[model samples]
Target: MTASTTRRTAATKSRIVAVGAIAVAGTMLLTGCGDQTNDGEAKETKAAAAPLADKLPQAIRDKGVIKVGSDIAYAPMEFMDANNQPAGVDIDLGKELGKVLGVEFKFENATFDQLVLGMNSGRHDIVMSSMTDTKERQQGASKDATGGADFVNYFKAGSAILTQKGNPKGIKNLDDLCGLTVAAQRGTANEDLLKTQQKKCGAKKIKEFISDQDSDSITQLQTKRADAVITDFPVALYNELEGGGGKLFEVVGDQIDAAPYGIAVSKKNPELRDAIKAAVQKIIDGGTYGEVLKKWKAESGAIETATVNAGK
Candidate 1:
């Protein structure tokens, strides 16, 4: 071969070798991009997973106190007992519930409306109030502000009217108190029921009290500002017995509509909800539930069944 041909041949071979090296480098670059892309995605996943506890089951055992929210206005269910300390069927149950769960019990008192807001804001954990579980309230109670769990029905309830010994006007039910003033706690089922009756039957005699505490209604009755006081059966019975066991006032008419009193939890806190439900079941199974009702003089209409099942 000629020298020029040899030189050209050598140059061509070197070019081929250089091109092959470029190809290998390009392949490695592509492979490296793929791996780096996957790595970036994995980092993002880790970042997103940082709040896993927010979605995972809540650690109920860690929360030393089962922070409960209550109005403390509804007597016999939850209120200031004879010793000026919190006592009632619900209070007793809550105490037992905490004891069973190996947690301390803490209560924060607020008005009915404030209780709902407090639960939503995480100011309190569960509400031990004798609150009726309704569709609208259930919707509100299932919200994040309410802690992400639905209500667990623990007791059955219905409304009733409390009046002076004679029931002078013979006010038998909501129908009879059309024009006469009726007292009820603000932002409660009693007031809601009254509003519903007024809207449906054109009755507008409702006097809203600041709280469901017995003193509020007793004061209203003593002053004759209200003709009758509408509240729950347990509360009505409690008030009547407080002054002297039906001697000062009388329970008038039958209960108006059936309702279930439920303990509310956050929608995200199913673990805590289940814990509470389990504690409640323990109380019911141990016969402590009935004893509490009897001690509070609320055994007649207290709940005998539980409907709180976890993961449902």
Candidate 2:
């Protein structure tokens, strides 16, 4: 039992202690890792189980952003302001609508011709352009208004002709364009109306203009390439007013056809439709609608509020 025996016993005890401490630390780390993995899996499961629509509204509410779409070419209704931001009656209406729904309005710029297409393609949640509630457009093409009754009408309008100041060509009506060139934006009801007149009334030689909102059609008039330009009554009137009213252009006769401006929504989604209709009604009730029209100097027209469940 000498000095050698004592040293050997001490060394053996130290090694055993070290091994035990290492094992305990390893076990604790493994337990901690396992708990973290379990917590993450539970969170994922809860998220996956939630319904998309139920989750979407909350996300929108939390973010305070409502993505809105519009063709910014139309004036007095919806257009880009000098600051390059969205402005107009429709733009103002959209902001109010978003507020009613408890969200911030974020406008996405698009062409007047592509607004509806963009909505149907799921690129936007709402379209605030001066869209007419027609049966054909409701069903995504020119046809019957069978499924179009679901939309909510915000304004009413038709078509009108914008001609050079004083009607120099004597282009008083659709009849004057028998063989003369007439310009209308492509994909618009104006284009359709002109084509129909050409066939039924013999007003042939119509000129189809692409990007009709950028003063290009007016350019056609200035250069004498087009005898006249056909567009929505509001737009035609605005052009005449901004273009020096009677000094640069004039609107001849009354608007063609009868239509109402409406905001389009998916026919299958009645809830969304109801929500939008409610927002629009709130604007009208709050007197914001009239204020917007006055700000843009838009022609006052008949406004009939449709019930949320009326057409549905």
Deviation from native of the Cα of residue 129 in model 2, angstroms: 1.5
TM-score of model 2 vs. true structure: 0.73
Clashes of each: 8, 1
- lDDT tens per residue, model 1, 200-280: 555354444544464587668757777888888887887778756566777898887757778987666777776666667
Specify the highest-lDDT model's number: 1
Residue 113, candidate 2: Cα error in Å is 3.7
Model 1 clashing-pair count: 8
For model 2, where is the 10-residue window of minimal lDDT? 47-56
Alpha carbon lDDT at 196, candidate 2: 81
What TM-score against the true fold does each predicted structure earn? 0.73, 0.73
Span of ten consecutive residues with least summed lDDT in model 1: 49-58
User: What lDDT tens digits, residue by residue, belong to model 2 across residues 111-137?
Assistant: 666666666676766666676666567
